[model samples]
Target: MNKGLFVMALEVSNLNKRNVYLMYLIIFLQGFVFYGPVAVIYRQRRGLAVSSIFIIESISWILMIILEIPWGYFADRFGYKKTLVISNILFFISKIVFYKAHSFNMFLLERILMAFSLSGISGCDIALLYSSINEKESEKVFGRYSALSNAGLFLASIISSILVKYSLDSTALLTSVFYGIASILTFFLTEVEVKNKNRINIKLCIDFVKSSKNIILLIFAVSLINEVVQAVAVFLYQIKLINCGFNIVYFGLLTAFLQLVRISSAKTHVLSSKFGQNKSLMIFFIIITLSCLAFLTLKNIPIIIIALALMCSSSAMISPIILDIENKSISIQDRATVLSIYAMCGDILSSAVNVVIGKVSDISIEASFTFCIIICFFALILLCLNFKGQFFNKYS
Candidate 1:
């Protein structure tokens, strides 16, 4: 890296750092708010059938898909900080609505707004971060960003669990408070001038699509497969524990432990740098496969706990590696848009899989895990082929 570039990378304006941190805080609040009432909502709401839940989630994802490209263009033209502030405001309002929501219809409305708000925030935050850091130092900065974000997630989950354990009704209110705080913090963030201030043309989008075809496909496929597998495993594991008379708190703790391990492992970049991106991803996929198999075979709580840890660690490993690969392939100008498209692919697949997993769980829990393993097997094969291609030539 050039000396000047190195200095520039480290010299992010105070405003940008503040903005990124605020986005991180909002993401933390988002997870906290969403997960806090999930199990309780399903358990207590008489009208909230599986189909209703799926519909709400599907609507959210559909909204995300519709908004992703336009919002990415908006951020590019208007500025990332402006987009962040707007998103935070929307999210704060959504949280309030969610707290006061009385019926499934109201919940769905709140969720759709929440999804749009979150989608706006997603790509813009990363684009701001990439703009602030030098291209050469982006990987290191992104790694740190991911680690800190995961730590925030772990803390939020712990806090949300405590809130839910004490009073389900209060959880939404508490989450809304956090969202408000995050929204307020956004006011302090500085705006980054987007490189291409002109309106995004179809030509740019098309060129980006053309340039990113292979890597985009890889990211999409891996993300879709991974989410499906993880969702199935989580659904089955939760049901199994509940049926076997395990405590809910224990499950929360198990989830917290998994996140903690993921946070810890994300800080270690040795494997990523040494083995190369594809190899590291391959290892993670293999670990996930083995973990899923272990979960299928093991009946012991302690052993299953270990399997969960492995599962999360493997899952955590995939995102950064894929992001790193994608980053290398696209220009900074279109990076966020490309990544959002990548995420949208996963969201679409996961939404569909959530419905299928819900039905499968009702029939046989083991069948879900078996299905996930099959998906993982397909993922592994695709990944292996990806590793053998020209894509690996540049990275490895």
Candidate 2:
């Protein structure tokens, strides 16, 4: 390469680092409103039943699945930066609604708003970041991004623990402020120029499907791992803590602990290199399987904590590896749409399964955990089949 060309590339790399830093800041500010600790507790305090809460969450995922592609199309056609700003605005509005909500119906409305906002965010954010840097750096970049986002959650967890002790409403109010700040930060995001700026249409969709079908299949195969761990198990673990006679005030602290574990685990390459990505994924699946068993068989706090650590570690490990595969396999112009399709797999599963999980939890928490164990076993089998067939060879 010419010296001048090399210098220009170096300058662009430096600029990309700056943009990534801005993204980190936005992620951190949004983390200040950490709702994970308060999510179930907040609904219970508002007089909604557990099943009702799960139904609301399921509805949210349903909306996410419905709106994901459209919002992804918007990001591709309009602008990732503008779409992100709109998403932040929607998040702010949702938080305000959540703060003012007194009835189940009111909370449902808030979740609907939230789903749309998150739909706009999930695909576009990753697409923007991946586009900003060299393709080879995407996995490393996502690892750093996940770590910083976890750090934000860790800090927020401390405040959330204290705030929830005071009032759930207070947490909601502060969360809204965080979203407002994050929205402002989005204005500073550097937009990547797309070479093929085509409008979304049937032909485009068909092309995406044809090109990404294999990766999409693999994505669906691993989707259960994510849904079972993050969407289902974590919430149940909170209920488990409450059942074990722990005070609600400690929920935020517990959430923070998991975030710490995730922070440690987000550095993907070391583990992937050591075990190989395929074997590493197998290890994570086995760990999750074991954790599900622990929840079913153990009641001691120490055992519960160990199980949660495994869950968190596996959750962190799987995301970047899978994301790198999905993101790198697609074209820049179609990145958001393809990634949305990937997310839609997980959302579809979570939406369908949460209601059943909720009802089972209502009947028996152990039964719910048992149900998860069965799903994990099935997921493990699917993963094995994929690997044995060399499904991920192309990505590797």
Candidate 3:
């Protein structure tokens, strides 16, 4: 549904409508990073080796892994609005730190701040959004919510095509200003009513995951696909672009095209509704699998664009449906915490896959893609293994 039509049909409070639109604006602003289109090259030009950048990222990932559950617990126990308000401020601070950073230690500080900021907001944002809307609208709302970030990136990439020509530092500075504005907006968000639950903590989240067989299976299967997507689309695409003789100056335009592909996220609800969640997920997973196969065997421009479209479109389509399915398993009282647990498990899988893919990529890009193909196949196998009648159908 269109945004205006959705609003007209909402049957929700004015405050709820405000929360939805406000969050859309906030998420879109968060994606307005001028440096994003050229993150690795920008870092390299700022006096750090690619290896050092990876090390910083590894540390940042580890830190977020450590913090995700605790932050979720905080959101569940206190309030989502409070968590968002705090985390968005931290997010802006991290962007400012990035703007000024040139040395490795300085960059590490930025990463550390980002770890705090990102982990704190991990599942809280979605939980808040899910709370504010009617359940039937979840898919449409989440789809558009997912797309707004890419819409921002689409705009940023256009700006970056201009900005990277001048100063990379300017990209970070401009990005910080948008983030600072977003941070302030969080202060005005209405908090969803959180149920008072006892002993909300990391241990509780751990226990919940351990016992929820369906959720455990779902998270593992989906996370594997997400990791491969991040590796192939985000990390490897840049390298492939360079290997194919694309110059650095055109990186923004190229990445912008990918973001344009991701904008298909807004239509995810249609796919999931037509195919059913499990079948929809399987179809998209196969799409990614074929795209990886292309990476392993083909390198022409048309093939490159086709493979990218396949991967990005599949990824965009999958996220909101996955979020919607996962939320179905969560109780209202533990929504934030359980969602964080889902994120943590996904991160654990991602961190491991990233380390292996990084090492493999150092040997051969083809070899790295081969590894991604295996992950995709494994994910497909997991998807097949799911007993929809037992797991998904119950929720449906």
Candidate 4:
């Protein structure tokens, strides 16, 4: 009995390492069901106009923005495991709604549900992984997580493409099944112990902002750039491709190709090591801006694909790096709440921009791309401000 107990303790001590791999698996499942390849096309097939689709997506962003900080506070008070489980379950239910819905109102309902699910998961997942892993191994674990997630998307793009070829309803059904499995997987996750489970409110957020105002601003700026590009890519890029004279069959393949680019770019820390973090971040931001410019001007499929590859690569490269920065910038106890605040600011921007993009797209997809180019420049300006000395060094 003593020997068995000793061995059990030994295993529990090493659980963080195991959790890293488990997180990778969980993130991969999420990517698989993200349904990126067929999302926009599926809405169009369901008879939703592009403008209406954006309105629905905007509503999702609005809900997410509203709930993000509160959900994070709840996770901090209650526990990460329960919040994550609820997120998966809510997502599964949303997928079911999506599968059965033939009307825009039904899809709107699904988006609302999905927004709540996303709000719960956004900060909690990263906070859980950070709390579980050794601080030294964070960058490596995050890189692996991002890579595996993209690989899952790579597979999902193909699977969703094939399933969508059969029917949009079929794609939704399969996505729900994936989420169901993911929900079951959450039950197996080891919970991170929290010492302070007291209820925290908006003051916690205000304190964080006061301490790390610059970093928070920088994080929000980058997040806005990332979410806008992501929203457009997932929901409207297919339309851009269609305008470029590509067939629907190639959408999945193209999306799969972007995932590969993202996977390859996931190791931005390596770039940071080679060329200091500031310089490396600047380079990637410049790449993103240039890619947007290319998309603005280029009409050929090959050129557009190249531009998309650059955009995805930069977005993937910067995500974990920025999270690593934010993780270091704030207190561990307040991590999830602060991070949610960061994301909520971006979603607020996303909600507003989604409507504009949708409306502009009604006139011309090219004009929409032009709008994206302008947004990228705004992000670049913010990035430049942060790179100045002591700019993000307020609390750090």
Candidate 5:
């Protein structure tokens, strides 16, 4: 047997098992971030001002955006497993750094590490998973892939309810410990061999992507909705809860509920099979638009919780569908690179939305949600455009 083909030939069963199981386990472990509920409080306790923290986050986003394509290229050129191993190591190191960080600069260092780690993992992990599984199983695998992370996050948020009241440092330490396990798990992942390992031609790739923008538009549109829902959930929901006189201590419980709703991502394949992809996604964006609208106007807690659940469900359900579409639209040779570019476009827009949301949030939470409404409208429009042309008859 050729040395390069040994894993594929002799270890077919093991390769199939390790790639899927390890990725799921790694993602779940990575989600055990005990500091998730108290990230802001932890930073404030460490003496960083809100402005400085936002600045650091923005810088990290920028760095991640800048490195996204390059990291993807590296995964394509070198190997996916190597990239994931290096990325997981950096991710664990970043967690450890966060555990020890006290000053603004120290926290900034952790973000810097994260930008590199996350950028590398973005396209490579999916590319690896997509390669390992039969095409028919993509939906179930991707669905479970998404749900398990929420499961980890849900469990972590529950633990955070107690851990936060006791010790923030311990919270950071335990989070890092889970991340440490994630790093080790990456070592067990089997790399699916790339069909084309030749050096990428930059200009040719650019022209090719330009020609394929329609299929790409699907993820871009979904990204807009996902980012808006995510920003609202992470940044502003707490304020809304507090304004309604909800106690801060139960925030972890509230967060757990949100994560619980996100578990609906695993059911999206069923929804897509029932309604078809276009209808299911259209329904999601419509739910998002209405959710944002209700969140803006309603004072009723039950109504608000229902709206948030719809938004979370919409956001989670769209991801796997978009990913399936994206993977089908690309050739195996350039899959990781194209996916990274797609993700980069989404990140760029996310940064813009975050800026819009942050600025408008300072003015009023209502204004921020209003901006999300406008974004959802555009996303809904783009989602329709994705399936309209003759091009998608080929990819769709």
Candidate 6:
């Protein structure tokens, strides 16, 4: 096999699976800690305007967008381990600040710090995982990583529900403690070497942008649509469940259940290779559209649960497929930066959509769901047009 082709092959043994698994565990714990407070922020701070909460989130995302590529480049040069350690320490500090925050401004400050820390860590972990594997197997390796991370998030959601029910402040403190643990565990991670130690030149960024324009555009569009759908679901589901007389605990449980379904569905790689990424994505989009439509009509707990599961599962399925395609198209050296750009686009769009959706929810929950359906439909059309050719060819 050609050297480049040989490196592209993804085998499980080639990766430091144990370290990846540990990273996944720490991330899962981090999610559980972070989200426990976030899941109830709107409810806890109900006195504050919903617009205020959205603005804070939007600001955080904007900060993340600005920081992502710089941090990715830093990782590419300094080593992934160093970046991970710094990110975890920053995360720990941010959690402390969040725990002590007494006002909205304080919270926003902590949020900004958190966003910066998260940006520093975002693509670096994936880059490390990719380095551990052969280049060809990057997609499959990333798929497994995605699945594990989702599973962590899912588990964290469940724990968050339990902690939030008892005491939000305590939950915040506990989450901070978990971050400390994650930071400690970071020391155990093995460092990966960058073959080229040259400073990240402007040309590399330009080259990545030029070469991966189509994939980048598709990723941005899909990410924005996905975020809108998610934001709407977040706002709509809360109101819908409340209207249906479900308690907060039950709502959290339902959310956790959906995450579990998503994590499980994400692990399966057969769809991407067998049906092809583009076709698989289209099918998943259809499922999401149907699920959202069902949500508009379904009121019963059982039916709503089923619909939410389908929506979550389908969304989760689409991510790995899209990411696999994205990973396949980029060179190893540019992978983190390219992925950071992709993430930045998604975060910016999602933040904007959240603000809009929050305002729309205040006016009418039904209208918000209607908006989501429209967005998903448009996304479906884009996927169809962009992916008309075989999955890999569209980007290649």
Error of 1 at 382 (Å): 2.2
C-alpha RMSD values across all candidates: 3.8, 2.6, 4.5, 2.6, 3.0, 4.4
lDDT of 3 by residue, 1-396 (tens): 599788865645778789999999999999898898888877878898655765677777788889988899899888999999999999999999998988999999999999999999899999999999889999889899989999898899889989988887888899999999999999999887787655565565677677777667777788889888887777777778788877778878877887888989999988887888778888899999999998888878678878988898899989998888888777546889888888888788777777777777768888988999999998887777665535555687
Please report the candidate that would top lDDT against the real structure.
3
What is the model-wide C-alpha lDDT for candidate 2? 0.79
lDDT by residue (1-396, candidate 5, tens digit) is: 588697666578677778899999999888788887767768878997645665676777788789988998888888899999999999999999999999999999999999999999998999999988888889878988998998898999999888877787988999999999899989888777776677765555556677777866776787788878876666666667667776767777777887899999999899999998888888888998998898889878778878887888788888888889878877547778887888887788777666666666667778878888999899988878886863556667
* lDDT (C-alpha, whole model) for all candidates: 0.68, 0.79, 0.85, 0.79, 0.83, 0.70
Q: What is the C-alpha lDDT profile of model 4 across 62-101, one tens digit per residue?
A: 8998899889888888888888999989988988998887
Residue 288 lDDT, candidate 6, scale 0-100: 79
TM-scores, all candidates, are 0.85, 0.92, 0.92, 0.93, 0.92, 0.86
Error of 2 at 277 (Å): 1.3
Worst 10 residues of 5 by lDDT: 200-209
Q: Which stretches of candidate 2 lie over 4 Å from their true place?
A: 1-14, 210-213, 231-233, 391-396
Task: Please give the RMSD of candidate 5 to the true structure.
Answer: 3.0
| Superposition TM-score, candidate 5 onto the true structure | 0.92
- In terms of lDDT, model 1 sits at 0.68
Task: List clashing residue pairs in candidate 6.
Answer: 7-135, 7-136, 8-135, 8-136, 8-137, 9-136, 9-137, 10-137
Off by over 4 Å in 4: 1-9, 199-202, 389-396
Q: Where does model 3 exceed 4 Å of error? A: 1-12, 197-205, 388-396
Span of ten consecutive residues with least summed lDDT in model 4: 387-396
RMSD of 4: 2.6
* Candidate 6, 145-206: lDDT as tens digits: 66665665666667767776776667577778878988898888877666565766647765
Clashing pairs in 5: none
